[model samples]
Target: MQGSLSEDRRAQGEASAGLIRGELEKVREEGGSGAYGVFGEQRIAAALKRLGCGKEHGVYIGNGFYSVHTGVVCVSGYVTKDELTSEVHGAYAEPQPGTGPCVENRGGH
Candidate 1:
């Protein structure tokens, strides 16, 4: 069961990252928020949650979904921690000023 869960989490992470990369690319090309609206933040948060570990990750996922009403987006596996951190930080920066630059701790326990 533990192994399966780990696999599931890994798959979820990959899927989330993929969606995020595609959306981000489109956002870059279009030079705007695209269809995500305020919810774009949620999508990003979801992707991070899939990869991260902790109760804080759950909080982030909840806020992210609430924030990104558009749809679930993913981050690609190729994305480095730095890139992911920057993207997540940028998404929630303005609306979540109290959150600060949200970076993935990686060593979630």
Candidate 2:
């Protein structure tokens, strides 16, 4: 059972990697500013979940810029559990002032 689970996780990771690669290809083909929006982020998060990455896994969307044009937009983040936790915690610790409340609190008041 353990071996099977490991194999499943591996397969999921591979599939996720492929999906991410496809997104990257699209961004490249569209000249970087292709507008991945939340689509790529959701894909990465789903892939991580499938691979049993847990909340400690961080999924980052990175964009590069060049002269008068956007460069490649890709996943420049790591898949390590520790790094993921750090990334998430760091983001939470930072204050986004002037953003006008959190998304969850928008409709409360």
Candidate 3:
């Protein structure tokens, strides 16, 4: 069961990469004539990478950066339920969408 979960995560990551790439392409196709801050695609990539999605997952940009958790929340702050679910579903088989708490490791020696 654990192995299946891992595989599912990997697959999810790959799918996420595909969806993100498509969205980016759409944005590019639309063409912009102004400066831009980090946006949804960037944020999504950051979050997915932080969640253990690797480069092979296709979430990394040419600059070799992934979506940090903060980036995710920033881009998705205005997401609707249907949109959020659709986007998240592209990755995980389960709707476990969230940047779970991050705990620091302390030495216990």
Candidate 4:
């Protein structure tokens, strides 16, 4: 189960990268300031929702970096037990979604 979950996180994170890149590029094209939250939270949420991972997930984007947090979460600002952050280019995941008190480490903006 853990293996599968990790694989899923990796795959999902990689897959979402392209979408995020496109959105960021669009912002740049539109003359938007190169700043965090430029893409807005609603847009990010909508984009991630398409991935179909319905446990706990979110996205954080800033400057030229982006991170996607999925699995091992129960909702925004919360995490499950056995919380382990498997990071890949700012992205993170876990073997399986736990039920702990792992607050989101959304990084400094």
Best by lDDT: 4
Task: Please provide, for model 4 over 1-109, each residue's C-alpha lDDT reduced to its tens digit, 9 standing for 90 to 100.
Answer: 1222366555665555545445434444544332342444444444445655322454443323334554432222211121212233322233212422223344454
lDDT of 3 by residue, 1-109 (tens): 0112255555654565455445444444444313333334454454455545544432333222233122122111212112222222222222122322111112233
Off by over 4 Å in 3: 1-5, 36-109
Provide the lowest-lDDT 10-residue window in model 1.
67-76
Alpha-carbon error at 95 in model 4, in Å? Answer: 16
lDDT of each: 0.33, 0.30, 0.33, 0.38
Model 3 alpha-carbon miss at residue 59, Å:
14
Q: Residue by residue across 1-109, what tens digits does model 2's lDDT show? A: 0112245554554455454444444433443223432233444444444544333333333232100000111122332212221110112222223221111112222
lDDT minimum window of 10 residues, candidate 3: 73-82
Candidate 3 similarity to native, TM-score: 0.30
**Model 2, residue pairs in steric clash:** none
lDDT of 1: 0.33
Model 1 agreement with the true structure over 32-82: per-residue lDDT tens digits: 332433235544454444545223333333222322211222121222222
List the pairs of residues colliding in candidate 3: 45-67, 46-66, 46-67, 46-68, 47-67
- Listed in order, each prediction's TM-score against the native is 0.31, 0.30, 0.30, 0.36
Candidates 2 and 4 compared: the better one by TM-score is 4
